[model samples]
Target: MGTADAPVILVTGASRGIGKAICELLATQGAQLVMAARDGEALQVLATELSAHGAPEPMVAVIDLADADAVAGLFKQVFNRFGRLDGLVNNAGVLHEGLLGMIRAEDIDRVLAINVKAPLMAMQYAARLMSRTQRGSIVNLVSIMGVNGAAGLSLYAASKAALVGATRSAAKELAAKGIRVNAVSPGFIDTDMTRAMPEAAHARRVASIGMGRAGTPREVAELVAFLLGGQSTYVTGQVIGIDGQMVV
Candidate 1:
């Protein structure tokens, strides 16, 4: 049973990169974390470290978001164990880059399943729990590519764009219940995924950004924290970009 002062937050894709950074910062804020990801070992390691550092030992749900049943079960476990859900961060997603004509059906399905459907389903369950208290917040991790066009990232962009639209609709539907939903559209960020880009391409991308550098996962995590916390109580149904003014 969690107290009011110690809110319970469920963060998907919480094993590494941006997800890991979000969990790390939220731990410091005294949040009782429910970490979900396919990497059980990594999740356990993070749980151990956070516990050792004085944060509450996070509840780990090792799940493949591609499996709809597994995603639903995760929420069931969260409510059964914690009795409430105060916040949710839909950070689990896949970026499959392929040109429109060359893209395959299976690839599109996989990307949409993990990126779009998973978040929507998570929101459905989270909203049910949130409705009980009439207070909760959700932050969906969208992408700047969803807002702008990218040549080789058509499928990824489509999935993200779908999430962005859903974010607004969900926010409106849940707002009357005192549940706030919003999105974070991250631009090029310094993460394991972005680090794999070719040197020339990465350099060109960075040079184009107004900041002359890629944003850090920690920077995005900070915005997520603000939205989930009390500071953004009046903010809802909005998508804020953390792209260093690149998209502008």
Candidate 2:
């Protein structure tokens, strides 16, 4: 059994992208992991990889984040098996492209359910767990689009903005319990999502970033580890942008 000295970090959406990187980083630090995502086969593979890298085998929960009942079940499993949760990474989200007028209501609702409602439920449950221990951290994966409005991303931007607001309120409400809440807003990153974008659109997006290139998942993961770890004990309710100076 992992003890308090070994941080117990729970990462949602750990099958790929930023979530995958975060799990690897925390695992490298000897943190016991409780990995959750919809892809069961992928999550099992990642758990094996983490164990190979010297981390204890991670507990896996394959559930759709959009399902509120499934999310509640996940937390229940965490409490039952882990007994304490040191940190939570609410990194599960979906991005649908289209202007506000062009997007269908169903698409918007889907985005909100996954990106906004899922995280909110996770936060609510995590807060309860942390309050018991009087120590924990929540690192939200927001987006740079939320900071500066991006064309054709109205629904996505609005969901992230709502999360930013939730992060602040949660930070304040849970401060006394020693729970630090913050957000890491990533700039354009080279991932499965971006690789799927049209070539011209990707190039245009890269040009807007001062760094002239997209960020890697590992870079964002490093920042997330720092915030979730004890290094930022005094930091709370802040949104740190990691977008390669894209919005500056």
Superposed Cα deviation of residue 225, candidate 2 (Å): 0.3
Name the top lDDT candidate: 1
Q: Model 1, residue 195: displacement in angstroms?
A: 1.3
TM-scores for all candidates: the values are 0.97, 0.97
Q: Which stretches of model 1 miss by more than 4 angstroms?
A: 1-5
Predictions in order: lDDT: 0.94, 0.91
In candidate 2, what are the lDDT values of residues 1-248, reduced to their tens digit?
35456877889989999899999888888898999999999999999988987788899999998899999999999999888889999998888778778999888878999999999999999999999989999999999888687899888999999999999999999998899999999989888878888899999999999988999999999999999987899999999999887888
Where is model 1 poorest over a 10-residue stretch in terms of lDDT? 1-10
Off by over 4 Å in 2: 1-4
153-244: candidate 1 lDDT, tens digit per residue: 99999999999999999999999999999999999999877888889879988998998899999999999999999999999999999989
How much RMSD separates candidate 1 from the native structure?
1.4
